[model samples]
Target: MTVTEKDRDILARTLWGEARGEGLAGQIAVAWAIRNRVDDGKLKSWWGEGYSGVCQAPYQFSCWNKNDPNYAYLSGAMAIPFRELAQCRGVADQVTDGRVPDPTGGATHYYAIAMPKAPAWAAKARQTLKLGGHVFFKGVP
Candidate 1:
């Protein structure tokens, strides 16, 4: 894909909102999952189109949800910490440019392990990789 500056910014904000507390590897893993969705031909109706569309799709990334705790920071209504946002932007740039290998094994979905129950969708998908506090999955119909 032809990633624009808006795409890069959206990806960076997503990384900051979703995986800021995780290590570098964890953030990249999450980014790869989003990239995987962008590459999914079957999901073009909703998930494909561009990084911004995929990341902001309703219910896809909770951090973009208005009620989500990270919404303010992600929407630019609040300031994100410089250090964390910079780290996310660096990783976003590298991964989007193919400077880093995908570590999620082609996963298109993940959820933090801390959730009380795994989502219904994950039950039908194959577990691909686990990084930091999240579990990644692929092969979902």
Candidate 2:
């Protein structure tokens, strides 16, 4: 897919919001998950159109949810820490441009390992990769 500047920025913001503390590999894993969603062939609406669409799709990435603590930084209501945001942006660019491989093995979903419990969708899905604090999954309905 041809990634525009807007898509790149949105992906970067999503990485910053979702996995900033997880470092570069974590950010790339998250990016792969988002790209996997874009290629899922299920969501055909604006929500699945491209990088921006997949990242902003409601409930897909919790960081964009109104109730999420990261929403403020993601929506520009609060300032993201400069260094963290820059790192996310750099990773976003690399992932989108194919400089990094899909380390998550086409995973379309993931959750932080610290979560009290894995979501129901993860119960039967194929675990693809584990990087930093998150675990990636695929083949979920």
Candidate 3:
């Protein structure tokens, strides 16, 4: 399906395992996405199998830097939309060092995921990976 018609959904698949810690948050954070073939209990079935949880809030992402020597040089070589990059940054935020790029490639917009108990970043990465993209997780960040 085209990115525009994705009807996208985000799921936070805790990288460290957010199994209820302190007042909240636990060991890890992750996100995931699932669409088109639903079996009613699909989400619940995959909750632990692959998905850690879901992100029920807005996320931030960018694509340029004005202070850097490469000012106007798309942040991290990202020239995609804030969301397209957001899907990448969400995961990169916790996976890579300084993955959060500057917001300048496009208009900044926020969208909500259906999952509240999960990290939104992880969920977005999963969706992009499913589309044949490579997402490397950060080590011991």
Candidate 2 lDDT: 0.88
Q: Give the alpha carbon lDDT tens digit for every residue of 1-141 in model 3.
A: 222112122221221112112111111122222211121244443322211122222111111124433223232343334543344334423322223332211111122232355444444432221111112122101
Q: After superposition, how far is residue 97 of candidate 3 from its true place, in Å?
A: 7.9
TM-score of each: 0.97, 0.93, 0.17
Minimal lDDT window, size 10, model 1: 41-50
TM-score of 1: 0.97
Quote the lDDT for 122 in model 3: 46
In candidate 1, which residue ranges exceed 4 Å CA deviation?
A: none
Candidates sorted on lDDT, descending: 1, 2, 3
- Clashes counted in candidate 1 amount to 0
lDDT, residue 110, candidate 1: 96
Q: List the global CA lDDT of all models.
A: 0.92, 0.88, 0.24
Write model 1 residue lDDT over 1-141, tens digit each, in one string. Answer: 799999999999999888998899999999999999988888879785789889999989999999999999999999999999999999989988999999889999999998999999998999999889999999986
lDDT-superior candidate, 2 or 3: 2
Q: How many clashes (backbone N, Cα, C below 3 Å) per candidate?
A: 0, 0, 19
Candidate 2 lowest-lDDT run of ten: 39-48
Candidate 2 lDDT, tens digit per residue, 20-108? Answer: 88978888899889887877676647456889988988778889999999999999999998988889889988888888899998888
Residue ranges of candidate 3 with Cα displaced over 4 Å: 1-79, 97-141
Better of 2 and 3 by TM-score: 2
- The alpha-carbon deviation from the true structure for residue 125 of candidate 3, after best TM-score superposition, in angstroms, is 27
